[model samples]
Target: MAEVGDDVYREDPTARRLEERVAEITGKEAALFVPSGTMGNQIALLCHTQRGDEVVVGEGAHCAYYESGAGAAWSGVQFEVAGRGGLFTAAELEAVIKAPAYYMPRTRVVALENTHNRAGGVVFPEDEVHAIAQVARAHGLAMHLDGARLWNASVATGRAVAALAAPFDTVSVCFSKGLGAPVGSALCGSAETIAAALRFRKMLGGGMRQIGVLAAAALYALDHHVERLFEDHAAAKVIAAALRDVAGAWVPAPETNLVMVDTPGIPAARFVEAAERRGVRVSAFGPHRTRICTHLDLPREEVLRVAEVLVEALREANAEASAGMGAGTSAGTVG
Candidate 1:
C-alpha cells in the first residue's frame, strides 16, 4: 500500500519522496507536487508575477491557449506572444520584452514550452534556451518552462532532463502526459520559489490530504516509463509516414510523440469524424489541422493499424471536400 499522510501539513512521505526525486532529476533546489499541470503552471505564474505584469510566451503556448486563462484569472497577468510559431528565438523574445514605463505592464517572466505541443512536439533547442536565458537575466526577467513532455525531449535529444531544465528558474513537469501516470505534476525550482508556490497552490484550492497514491504512480512512471518514451516517439514517426501519402494531408515528420496534420480544403472535423467512424480517435487542432498523439497505451503492433485508419479517414475527408460537402463548418477547438 502507498504511504499516506496529511500533505496539506507537508507530511506525506510518498509525495515528499516524489518531490525530492523530481527535484533531483530537474536539478532544482526543491519541488512541490500539485494535482495537475495546470495548477503547477498557475502556481509558477503566481510566484513569478505580480498583478498586471506581462509574461512573454511562444505562440500557441499551453499556458496561453489551453489553461482556461488561469494565468489571467488567478495571477492577474497577461501574455504577449513572442513569435509566430510555437518556438521562438532569443532575439524574438528580446523584441517582445516591454520597455520600462509606468504606463506599461512590466515584463516579469518568459514562459517556454519544451517539446512544444501544437507544433508537432518539437524540442526547444538547448542553445536557444541558453541564449534566451541570458537575455532574460539581462532584463531581470524570470524564466519558467512548461516541460510537461520533457521526458520526450530528453529521450529524443540524448540530453539529461536537468540539462534541459537548467536555464529555467522554475519548471513544471507532468506525470500524466508521456509518463502515463494517472494524475500529477510537479513544479521544481529554488526553495524560496516553491515555498511561495505552496501558498499559491493552497490559495488556488490545490491542497490535498493524502495524495501518496498519486505520488506513487508518478514515482513509478519516473522509474519505469522515462526510457520507454522513445517507443512512443518512434510510433509517431511511423504513423506520420503512413499518413504522408493521404490526399490533401500535409504530415510533418514528428520529432517526438505528437503527429500534426494539416488538411487543406477539408475541415479537420471531417477527418476526425471519419477516423472516429473507423474506431480511431484524433483531435482537431484547428479548422484545417488535426493532432494525433502516440502514448504508452499505443503499442508498436497497433501503430500501423491506427495509421491505416487515419489514412482512410483522410481519404474520406478528401472525397467529401471534393464533393463540396465539407464547407463552412467549424472544426471546433481542442486544448
Candidate 2:
C-alpha cells in the first residue's frame, strides 16, 4: 500500500504513515524521509542556512569528518568544530559563536551528536543538552541533533526519544544502523522547516520512489528492535571488560552499544588491521582508539569472538612495537 503510489506527490500511504510516526516519536510538527543520514543532515544545513553562514559542530562529529564537507560543498556554508568527545559546554558554544559582523560568517546553526560516535558512544547528558539549547535559543541560532544512534541513547538512558529530541530545531535519525532497516533516515522538524527540507532534499536528488518498503522495515524496528538494545549494550560492556588490560590497551566499559579500547603505544589503525586478520571488524576512531559497535545482527558468540580477537591483536601490536624499539636502539648503539 505504501509503495503503490508516488511520494513526491504525497500519495504513498506507507511513506506518509512512516513520516507521521517519526514526527510523533520525535515530537515534531512534521517529518520528511530521506535516503541516508548524511542526506538528512545535509538537508538540515541547507534548509537552515544560506551561503557563507557558519555552523558549529563537534571536532569529531560525523558532519565534520565523515560527511566529506557537504555542509560547505552543498550548503555553501563553513563549519566551526567545538570541543572534543562531541560535547561542548554552553560557554564553549558561546565562545565559538560569532557576532553578526560583516567580516565574520554568521553562526546560523549548532549541530550535536547524541551517543557521540567518535567519543566511544558517549551519551550526552539531558541537562547539558538543555543548557546548550538555551544558549542557541538565546543567540537565535538553530539546533540540530545528529541522533543517528538516539534510539540506543533512549534505551541506555531509559529516556523517551521525544525528550531527547525536545531541544533541537531539527533531528535526524537512522534506520539503517542499529535499527536494522536496509536503508532510510528521517529528518523531523516543524512544518515550515520540513517544507524547506523537502525542497532541499529534492535539490540534492534525495527524493525516492517506493520508499515505503524501507519505511516499513524502520517501523518494525522501532516496535520490535528498540527494547532489545539493552542486550547489545550489555554485551558490549562485557566485551570491553574482557579486553581490559590486554597489551596495555584499556577498554572503557560501554555506555551504550559501542566499546572503545584505548591503545597506549599502538595506533588504532594497526590494531584494526591485525584484528581484521583475525576475523573481527573494528573501526579506528582517533589515533589512539579502536571502537567495536554492537547492533541487532551481532550475536553473542560473535561478540565473544570479537573480544578474543581484540586481545590477540593488541598482543601482536605490542610485540611489534617492542621489537621496533629494540631494533632502533641497537642501530643507534651500532652507529
Candidate 3:
C-alpha cells in the first residue's frame, strides 16, 4: 500500500517521490504531477503566457489536434503551425515568428511533440531541437515539449530522456501512454515555473488529496516499464513488414510503437471493420488511413498473430473495394 497525504498541502510522500524521479530523469529543477497530459500542457501554457499570446507548434500536435481547444479556452492563446507533417526545423519556426508590433499577437512559446502522433510517430531530430531552442532564446520565447511518448522516443533512438528534454523550458510526460501506468502525467520545469504551475493547477481544479495511491503506480512503471518499450517497437515493425507487400496498402516503417497504414481507394472504416472481424482492432485515422499500436498487453506471439491477420484483412478489403468499383463502372456503361 502507498503512503498517502494531502497533495494540495504538498505532503503526499508517494507523489513527492514520483515528481522527484521525473524531475531527475528529465533534468528539471522540479516536477508537478497532474491528472492528464492535457492538463499538464495547459498548465505549461498558462505559466508561459499572458492572455492573447500566440504559440508556435508543428502540424497535428496533440495539444492542438486532440485537446479540444483547451489552449484557447484555458490559456487564452491561439496556435500557429510552423511546418508541414508535424515536425519543423529552426528556419521553419523562425519564418512564423511575428514581427515586433503593437498590432500582432505576441509570440510567446514554441511547443513540440516527440514521436509526433498524427505524423505517424516520427521522432523529432535532436540537433533540430537544439537549433530551434537557439531561435526561441534569441527571440525571447519559451519552449514546451509535449513528451507524452518521449519514453518511446528514448528507446527508439537510444538517447537518454534528459538529453532529449534539455532544450525545452517545460516538459509534460505521461505515465498512462507507453509506460503502462493506469493514471497520471507530470509537468517538469525549473522550480520557479513549477511553483507558478502549482497555483494554476489548483485554479484549474487539479489539486487532489491522497494522490499518492495513483502516484505509486507511476513510480512502478518508471522502474519496470521504460526499458521494455523496445518490445512494442519491435512488434510494430513486424506488423509493418507483414503488410508492406499487400496490394493497396501502404505501410510506413514505424519509428516507435504506432503503425499507420494508408489504404487508398478503400475507406479506413472498411479496413478497420475487416480487421475487427478477424479479431484485430484498429483505429480509423482518416478517410483512408488506419492506425495500429502495440502496447504492454500485446506480447510477441500475439503481435505475430496480428501481423498475419492484418495482411488477410487488407487483401479482403481491397478486393471488395475493387469489386464495387467494377460494378459501378459496368452499370454506367450499360446505361
Candidate 4:
C-alpha cells in the first residue's frame, strides 16, 4: 500500500497522509516529513531565521550540544543558551533578546526540547511552555519545539500532544524513537512555514523519492506504539530506585524513559564497559555519568533483571551504588 512516487513534487500519497496525521495531532495548520529529528529541527531553524540571526536554546539541548553544529553550519545562525534540563522560563527567554541595533544579531527563534534528553528525560512543565511562548511572541520571535520524545512526555504527563504543541509556531516530533518506527520525523507549523521548510529540506538533500515505505511504518507506530510509554517510564523509576542503593552510585529518578546514573568513585567508561560485559548496556555521558534508556525493547521483567545484573556487576567491580550526599530526595528526582 505504500508504493510511492516522488515526494519532492508532493506526489507521494502515504507521505502526504503522514504529514496530515502529524498536523492533526500537533494541532498545526500543516506538517512536513523529514528523514530525521535533526533534519526536522534544522529545517525549522532554516525556515524561521535569516543568516546571522540568533536562536535561543536550552543549555543542554540537542540543537546546542548534539546536532553537530548544524544550527551554525547549515542555518548560518548563532545560539544563546539558557536554562538547565532544557527548560527556560519566560523571563529568561525574554532577557536574552538582543536590543534592536544594527550590530546585534536579531533573536529570531526560541527552541525547546520536551522530555529533554540529557536531563534525565524531564518533561517541560506546561506552565513554563506557555509562559515562554508568550515571551517569544512578545519579542516577535518564532517558537520551535523539538518534541522528539514527545510521545513519552505526553504519556507521562497525561497531556495530549496537541496541547503541549499548541503554543509553538512550529514543532517537530520523531516517529523513530519511542514510537518504534524505523525512520522519520515530522515538523508541524503554519502552511507558510512548512512550505519554507520544504525548500530548506530540498536544499539540504532531505527530499526523497518513494518515502512512503517509511511513512507507512511511522503511521503504524502512531496507532500501535504511543499508548504504552508509561510502562517504560515505570521501568526507569524502578531502575533508578535500584541504582540509588548501589554503593558509591546515585541515580536521578526519571520522568520519562531515560535514567542518568552518577558514579562518583567509578569512571563512567569503566562502568559502561563492565556493565556491557555482563550483557547490560548503558550510554556513557561523562567521566562520572551514564545514561540508561528504557523502551519497548526492554520489558518490565527485563528491567528488574538488568537492575540486579548491574548491581552484581558493580559489586564485582568493587563499586556499589552508595547513597550519595543528596540521595534522600522525596521525589527521588535528581540529575
What lDDT does the true structure give each of the candidates? 0.92, 0.84, 0.91, 0.85
Give candidate 1 regions above 4 Å deviation: 328-335
| The best candidate in terms of TM-score | 1
Candidate 2 vs candidate 3: which has greater lDDT? 3
Screening candidate 1 with a backbone cut-off below 3 angstroms (N, C-alpha, C), the clashing residue pairs are none
lDDT of 1: 0.92
> Compared with the true structure, what per-residue lDDT tens digits does model 3 show for residues 253-313?
9999999999778777777778889988888777787888889989887887899999999
TM-score for every candidate vs. truth? 0.98, 0.93, 0.96, 0.93
Model 4 residue runs over 4 Å out of place are 317-335
Indicate whether candidate 3 or candidate 4 has the larger TM-score. Answer: 3
Q: Report the C-alpha lDDT of model 1 over 273-320, residue by residue, as the tens digit.
A: 889899988888888988998999998899889988988889988998
**Residue 80 displacement (Å), model 2:** 1.3
Residue 134 alpha-carbon offset, candidate 4, angstroms: 1.2
Model 2: weakest 10-residue lDDT segment is 326-335
lDDT of 2 by residue, 95-144 (tens): 99998799999999999998788787889989988999999999999999
Model 3 residue 41 distance off true place after TM-score fit, in angstroms: 0.5
